[model samples]
Target: MASVSVSFPKYMSHIPTRHAGHLAELCIVPRNLSLMKQGSVRELRIVRSSNQTEPLIDCTNKPSDIPLLSCSEATERLKQNREKHKGKQQFLAMYSSIYGGTVTDAAAMAIPMDDHMVHRGHGVFDTAATMNGYLYELEQHFDRIIRSASMAKIVLPFDRETIRRILLQTVSASKCIKGSLRYWISAGPGDFQLSPSGCNQPALYAIVIEDQSLFDSKGIKVVTSSIPIKPPQFATTKSVNYPPNVLSKMEAEEKGAYAAIWLDEDGFVAEGPNMNVAFVTKEKELLMPNFDKILSGCTAKRFLTLAEGLMTAGKLHGIRVDNVSVEEGKRADEMMLIGSGILVRPVVQ
Candidate 1:
C-alpha cells in the first residue's frame, strides 16, 4: 500500500481576521493516479479553525508532490500557450481604453472577462470600412452605435469626440488602407451578477481586421432564412447578441447560398442576415423594405442616396421604401444585398 501526505502554503492555513471563527477545508488528491481506477484511493483533507488545531489525514500511499509555479514562469507558460495559436490571430491590430485609461498594446487588446456585456450581452457594436485611409460612414456608424448604447442603457466611457479619435488612432495604428474597423461599448467589469448595478463603469474596445476580398458585382443567390427575425427592439439595435444572425448565415452556407434573407412574423421581407435587401421591378422602380423592424444599414442607405442619381439620369424610374412580400421579392427584375462588408451584391435567385 502507498502512503499519502498533503500540505498547503502557510498563508492558506491561516484564517482571515475578518472571518475569525470560520472554518476552511482543503482537499488534495494524487495528480499522477486516475481517481476512477480500481485502486484504494486516499485523499488528505485539511481543516483549519481559529479555536481548533489543524488536523491532517494520513493515507496508505506516499504523498505525491506538486510544484508551485513562480509568477514569471506562469507568464512564460501562458505566452508559450498563446504562441501556439499565433497563426489563428486574425485581427491586424486593436485598441482599447477601459475605465478612461489610455490605449495600450494592440497585440494585447482584451476586454474584462467579467464585464456585464460578456456574460449578459449588454453591449452595442458597429463596424465601418476603411478605404484609402478613409473610414467610410464612420460618423454615421458611430451615431448609430451611440443610439444603440442608449437603448441598451450603457453609459459611454468617453465622449463622442474622444471615441472618434480612438477609432481613428486604432485604424492608423493598424496601417491598413483597406480593412474594417469594428468596435464595441460594453458595461464594465464587476461581480458576475444578473444586474448591471454591480458594474463600475463602461468600456470601449476596437479592432482592425483585414478583409482582402475584392468587390465582386457578380450576382449571388440567397434563400429565405429559417431563423426567426428579431423583434423590433432588438432588430434596430446593433448589439452583440448575434446567435440568430450567425445561425441564419450558417443556414445560408449550408444551403449553398451566398446569404439568407429574413422575413418578419407577418411574412414581409425584412432584410438579409447582415445586410439590407433591395429589389428592382420590371418598371425600373427600386423598392427596399422599410427599416421599421430591421437594422437601418449605413451602406444600404448610402446606396439608396447614390441610386437617386440614377433616377435623375433616367437609369431608374423611381425609388420607394415599403413592405416587400416574399413573392414580390422572388419575382422582381433584380434583387441585391447591400452592406458595408459587401458594398452591393446582386442576387440571382
Candidate 2:
C-alpha cells in the first residue's frame, strides 16, 4: 500500500488547553480521504509554527503537481517538527484507549466519534490522583466508577483486576509523579442513536494529566445554588449527565463565589457542585450529610474513617452522618468541602 504523511501547523493555541490537541486532530483527519482512496495509508501530524502570530498550517491535500513524499522524507519532517515544538506541548502525557487495548501518546489519542458517551452521555467517569508516584485511593475511586457504570447500565470492557492493572500501567507509563488520572467507562462506539443497544460493548479511556496547582486550604465563599439539584436517583449515581452540576458551578462563579452548594428537595444541605460537604459542630462533633441523596464521596468517607482517631484522641466528641438542614449547616462552627481534587477546603460563608 502507498503511504503519505502530512504536517500541520499550530492552530491549536487558541483552543482551550484541555481540548485543543484533540480538536486539532479532528480538524485534520477528515480532509485527507483522497490519499486514502488511492490505497495510500495517511498519517496527519501537527507541528508548531515558527511565527507565533501566523495562522498554523494544516495538511489537507497534496497538489497534483507536487510529487508524493517518500517515507524517509516524512519521517525526517516529523522528527524536525517535534524537535521544534517539544517544549511547548502541554498535551496529555499518556492515555489508554480500551477499544484497541493500547496506551498511546496524548496527541495521537482520540476517542471514536460515535461512542454513546459522545452522543447520548451514556457513561460514567471517576478520577484519582498520583502524588509522589503513588496513586491515591485508586481502588475506592474505581469501585465508585463501577457502581456508576451499573447505575448507567453500562458493562465494563475489562475485569476489575485488569482495569486496575491498566490504570496503574497507564500512570507508570506517564511517569508523572504529581498528576491526576481521569478515566471513563462508556457505552462503546456505535450508531448515533438514543438507545445503546446497538453498541457492542463498553469502552474505557484513561489519561494522565500533569496538574501542579496546589490544593488551596484557605476558606472560600460559596453561594446557594439556584439550579435545581438532580433527584436522589441521578444525584447519587455519579453518571456523566452533569448539566445541572455544571450550571450550578457556573452560577457560583458568576456570583463571585468559589462554588455553589445545593440543597435537597426538602431544603437540607446536599453537596457542593462536585464535592461532599461536612461541618464541625460547636459540640466538637464532625458531621456529614447522609449519603442517601448525595454522591457518596470516597475522600469524605476516608476522612470519616481517619477522624475516628481524632475522637480517640479527644479532639472530637463524635462523628455523625445525618440529614443536615441548611440552617444548621450555616450555623456550624466550620464548614468544609471534600473531594479528590480539593482534599479539604473550608467554606467561609
Candidate 3:
C-alpha cells in the first residue's frame, strides 16, 4: 500500500509523521458525513510548515482556543489510542469478573460490573439527559442503578452524590461534546441457583454517549422476531442480563432489518430489542406493548409525556397508548422503538 501523509491543525503540536494512514478514521458528524458523495476521492491536507498554536481541544488563548483539526489528523491520533485493558478490566470484559459499568479503568485493577449475577439475566437500567451540562435525571438513573444492584446484591462503591461527581469527571475526560448520557450497572454475579449473591463490589459505571436516535423524520424498517420475551422479575431494575434482547436483535440482523419486536412468551408484541415498541393506527389510536417485561425507558417516558401534553391542548389527535397486541402493532401503518441509544426509531417491519 502507498503511504498516506497526515498533518495537524495550526494549534496542535507536531505529531510524528508515521501516523498517516490511520488518520483517516475520525468521522465527521452524521449530517456532514452523509452529504459527501460516496466513492469520491477525499483529499488529504498536509501542512508544509509548522507554527506554534493552541491545540484543538486545549487552546486556552482567548483569541481562538478551539482548533479545527482536519479529518486525517484527528483520525491518526485516534488510531494511536490503544484501548487495551491491562488488569481486572480484561477479566470483566471476558465475563470472568463483573461486567456492569459505563467505563472501566482497565489500567486499574478494579471490577466495575457484575457479569455473573443470576438476577442480571432479568434486570434493567436507564440513563437520562443532562441539562446545562448537568444530568437532567441523574438522580433517576442512580435510583435505577441501586435498584438493579439490590436485585442482584451488587455493592456499589459510591453514593448518589459521589457517583454524580464521577460521572462529570468522566465526561470532562471524554471527547463527547454534547448529547445524552449513559449508565451501565449490573447485578453482581452469583451462582446458578437463580439468586443474586456471592458477588461483591459489583461494577457501577456511567458515561455520556451520542444520542443518535432522535426524532429523525426518516422512518425505520423492522423485522419482528418469533422469539418470546421472557418475564424479567427485575424488569424495573437496570441490570446486564441482556441475552434475550441481544438475541432478538440478532434475529433482526439475520433478516437485514434495523431492529426486532420482542413478543411476550404468550406471543404478544412485547417491545423492541432495546426500546419500547409503539404504534399509531389509522383509526387515530396509540398502542404500546405491556411494560411488564420491558426495560423502563426514560426516552419512552418523555415521548409519552409529550403525547399527553399534545392531547390535552388539542394539538394531538390520537389516543395516548398504554398497551397494544402484537397482531395489532403488526397491522399498524407505522411502528417505532424508543430508547436511549436510538431515541425514536420508526420501523416498517
Query: Per-candidate TM vs. native?
Result: 0.77, 0.74, 0.59
- Model 3: ten consecutive residues of lowest lDDT: 88-97
Which structure is stronger by lDDT: 1 or 2? 1
Q: Which candidate leads in lDDT? A: 1
TM-score preference between candidates 2 and 3, better one: 2
254-311 per-residue lDDT for model 1 (tens digits) = 9999998899989999998899999999999999999999999999899999999999
* Superior by lDDT: candidate 2 or candidate 3: 2
Regions of candidate 1 where Cα sits further than 4 Å from its true position: 1-90, 99-107
Candidate lDDT values, in order: 0.82, 0.81, 0.57
lDDT of 2 by residue, 67-99 (tens): 688876865666576557864223454444544
Model 2 lDDT-worst window of ten = 50-59
